[model samples]
Target: MAYCYTASIFFPSSSSSSSILANDRLPHLAYRPAKIKRRLSFSCAALPFDLSPPPIDHDLLDTMTVAGAKVSEDGVIGTFDNDDEALDAVENGVAVVDLSHYGRIRVSGEDRVQFLHNQSTANFEILHEGQGCDTVFVTPTARTIDIAHAWIMKTAITLVVSPVTRERIIDMLKKYIFFADKVEIQDITQQTSLFVLIGPKSDQIMEALGLADIVEQPYGSHKHYSVNGMPITVGVGNLISEEGYSLLMSPAAAESVWKVLLGHGAIPMGSNAWETLRILQGRPAPDKELTDEYNVLEANLWNAVSLNKGCYKGQETISRLVTYDGIKQRLWGIRVSSPVEPGSTISVNGKKVGKVTSFTTGKRASQPLGLGYIKRKAASEGDSVIIGDDVEGTVVEVPFLARQIPPS
Candidate 1:
């Protein structure tokens, strides 16, 4: 097994032989200096406008009841009586959420399709109107730069990546466009708006907004429709257990749209609430649970990787890794009693096997749960491990239960 070092660095090209070393007295894992420029800080102002007051020292929210717990810190928002109830809220009830932490980029120009096809893991050229896909952009050496979801719009290509990879993705794209045709990259994270709706009742909210005749489709399916007689675009994603849909609109239309949904009975959930939902479902978010160091297979990103799709960057490594069973680690979920923190080591039989990436507590006083990367041999559900120093945790199967998706 590779030894843990302190420095965090990007492995740009497969052939490049530079290795990072860390000398700090912290965790003994290898570290590579993060490449992002710290131009924006959490203390800095939120772009466009700041809706809430300045963040308090303890900004975490709690949603608990007398019978059960809400969500815990580290971003778990609410607590439902059971898994089915939580899924029901997503499928049939309104689940208003704030995904502002997600990074957004805009690609425009005649060559946008070709440009993205060359840079992303998925076949961008195959994407038609109203459809979007999950893809990863990696360095020549196959280290991940960003995991992004891309959509084709009338005038531009919109990409949503993690905050950590936003700048690196932009820079990488720029370097690749050296001899390419017309293409412009712009950060439009704040200029545009995004929201998610999942459930049988979701249609009611869309219909309330005047989004008529919206045809139902499966995950990875999408189409253009009008809401409230206003032109809006929709994308289908991550609906393994319900009718799921993601909504995109101009910033100007966001407030009005939010009000309409609330009036239609949608529950305005914070970021933590949505994240807990995602984690419980085995979904991986950029940087938080996935990064450049992981291959698509290791990250359980099969939904996004199309085997039949033609060649793209890093396809060779993916194919080789899959064919040879070369995946070294797997991202899986675990339930722990102790508070788990990201970057902590996960051990089995007293040997280092994996590391924790994301962890959260119960809404009020429930047990702690976390998502971590583990050696494939150590990944079975019900397996046990220790987190941080003394926190005890157990591995659990994803989705935490059976998932049901709506009809196409």
Candidate 2:
């Protein structure tokens, strides 16, 4: 006797599912009776496949808004009040900057170290558990990709990358994976949050939070801790300030941790304040100072590049530049007589020497300060240059604080 069988499948009734699946891919039930009188029927249901990102924590957003945070379009706090007060907090007291938006990725497996070593500019093979260092990802032609800070854990290495370059870096790393290599890359950016505590009082605040041990550790040293059932990892690093401590925790734990630090007198800082401080520190930021338009050396990120490291992407070009002094332009600090827009040209005697990448109204310095790339042969510290058309400025040493003190 012949038998007929049919199957039916149902997916969630949502626009997301409809957009994700095509009509032909959607299965339906069909039955044809033959000599047999009986027919079999099977039914299946499939969950909707949603490709949207997770929603932001509204509770945390509301809390910050209530606390007088000027939230940016990206949802980060831009400034609680003004940049000047935040600058003061960084120099005198502790200031907390939410860096949760930064990208976080976890690299696991036995070959993770060697895999990263071959991909980036740092010597990752030498790092031990609890150690971390900044590294740069570059193209084959030695153009800047992004500078990532890696924290070595017992089982995996956690990479903190720029939010803009997160997906690109992940895709780039995955493309290099081979069948013989044992490596896994997981993007944990949404799963975790990061905060940076800056200022001279950062150590004191850590002690108050019962993290005195972390404060004593050197830069790039991290230790994990469980605080009231929430897992948190504290690390020492000079991200924006000379004495900065980074706290990595779950999104759910961010509110509580932020409150705890605030209870200990940590001021809330925002992006405006961050930009001013970053320019003052002479730190290269993604798309601004760190970009494919310039090489890593030209960005003045030599500390992040390891000269003794083995072969890596763009290694040959980087080595040649160093050996032959091929780097023509170098990042420098410019003290402008007035505010100047980024992308403004820096000229000497009507000849184009460089262009500004970052410009900030010096609320702390009571002047306009900027960072840009200048031809090494055209400018030196204390050389006068014209910003834009007629705005006069002088080339100064980076970490602008070294050349002039911030006003009290």
Candidate 3:
């Protein structure tokens, strides 16, 4: 009989899994609404699969319509709204979208820090109280195991990675545990909930809920706080003009937090809006674009890596790629004349050169754009590439949106 699991935390038998040595480590880790709150009906009784897929219960489509967001399911559609309500919700107020499908993993034990630092692409030792980082976990050969946001609570490190790569992340991390001391890995994805607070006014929203005091810090930094009196682990970062804070807490707290945001005038956005924002910002997500073959450098994750840090697993390869300028391809955003699917191939002069990773109808710019991995030398803003007949795209900068100052 075949067994299946929704996440990548399961331990394989000794004979089935390879005991690989890890060189180093790294880290990291949304919401919804009502009125539009309808009980979704998805039938699984007659389906061939025995396992039940998690249902989409947020009344996502209605929520988007009521909020006046342009809604499309093809991954490129945005809701049609006057006053740019989607953008407004992300600017002046807060928004919650379903992010449960994203992957998450936890690392614990006395050696967790040492193990992660050696295997990850960032400097874990510099992680202090109220700090987080964007980083990558790599295999011994320098392939990316997972791109993650790492947060440290005391000595415990939590990595919120892409679900598509969750298994490899677990397998890869476990491979390096031979003879390591006291490190227990757990997959707490189902037990915990993820809620994101994004907008220029995000701080105010947090303040209203008593999450934190206003302060100056980089995008990947955060502090512990409470929401509606519920304790939560918080991590913050800049996603375009909107500063983002992710709440790691219980499901009950998750619902209460969403209610509080709605009461505070936050526009509840659907997953569609979130996807559009992510693509427009050039953030690489798993399955949609991020994969094993893509390295951190090519994925535009430079801000996440710390060169001054000591050796970790795959450091030699990463160092060489960073200094030697030997990476052949790099990920870039492009303005395309036509819509392309996520996995569509990109070409130049009739030769295959790259592949499209994510595409979106820019709700703000009123144009279609895509994220793709192209040959490094050929990947430049304003450079034109062809996808199909009469379908051409021009390379553009990573982040199409500008940042805004927090309220004083």
Worst 10 residues of 1 by lDDT: 20-29
TM-score of each prediction: 0.70, 0.82, 0.73
Q: lDDT tens string, model 3, 56-162? A: 24233354456565655542224344334655677566665545445667888888878888878788887764567767776665666666777775647778787
Best by TM-score: 2
User: lDDT of all predictions, in order shown?
Assistant: 0.58, 0.73, 0.61
Q: List model 2 lDDT by residue over 288-380, tens digit each.
A: 887878988787666677788779998998899988889899888899988999899999999999999998886666858899999999998
Model 1 alpha-carbon drift over 4 Å, by segment:
1-88, 225-230, 238-243, 308-310, 365-367, 388-390, 400-408
Which stretches in model 2 have alpha-carbon errors above 4 Å? 1-58, 400-408
Ranking by lDDT: 2, 3, 1
Candidates, ranked, TM-score: 2, 3, 1
Each candidate: RMSD to true structure? 16.6, 15.5, 12.3
lDDT of 3 at 187: 73
Which pairs, if any, clash in model 2?
none
Candidate 3 error regions (>4 Å): 1-84, 212-215, 227-230, 238-242, 400-408
* lDDT digits (tens) for residues 192-282 of candidate 1: 5576775567767645443333436544554443222223355665322335567655443454455455567866664555566666666
